[model samples]
Target: MDAIERDDDDIEFVETAYANVAEFVEQLLLPTYRRNPAKHRWDPRWWEYQEVAMRLEALWRSFEYLRLEGPTGMAVFFRDYLDPTMRELTSENGPFWRLDKLGDERGVPDAWPSESPPRNMF
Candidate 1:
């Protein structure tokens, strides 16, 4: 969550930042989304997008609170938030909540792509 732990490649931040970024995701973000799926709905990807967007205002506040700007801010956003959510969304056992929520008594999951929940998500 702080600055990259190791910046071996000053020329390419991503290269040097990779390990630190993975560590950040695995350590902080991953736990929130992975171990505790209800902490956030990351399955089905879009739900995670929706959840993140719903908190966009807060995220922006965080962006400002952290005194981040431009690319650095974006990287922080990914490192602290998006990356872990993505991992959960794409996990082998992903979409857990989504699957759990679906398949009423009939036992047939609703693959309906009608609209985002809490409708009018825009």
Candidate 2:
């Protein structure tokens, strides 16, 4: 059997940059990020889509980690994480695609179809 080593530093709790994902998106992300309406799609009611909310939360967590990495932290965060994630999130085929087409009055669109795989496939 193999054993994994645990370090005290790993267990240390670090405070997050923002109180919640919404705070991060409203205060830092949305304010700083500029998107061309013609190319990227964004819905103000982002939380309605589970996938978008999850992705935003992930981005918020990533930002919290990267912000502590010194001067180059923000640049790397933008280049490595924010750019790609935002591109995908706002892409024509992304979670918000239907919202863009159907208009905000229609509400959230149905989730993409999926089927459960055989147990223990992993």
RMSD of each: 11.8, 5.5
TM-score of each: 0.27, 0.80
After superposition, which runs of candidate 1 have C-alpha atoms over 4 Å from their true positions?
1-71, 96-122
In candidate 1, residue 69 scores what lDDT?
51
Which clashing pairs does model 2 show? none
Of candidate 2, the 10-residue stretch with the lowest lDDT total is 1-10
The prediction achieving the highest TM-score against the true structure is: 2
lDDT (tens digit, per residue) of candidate 1 on 14-75: 22232333343445444654444334333323323444334433433343334335658777
Cα-based lDDT for every prediction: 0.43, 0.81
- lDDT for 103 (candidate 1): 24
| Model 2 lDDT tens row, 1-122 | 11212364455457776888999999999998987777777888899889889999989888887877889998999999999999998888877776554344435677679999999997
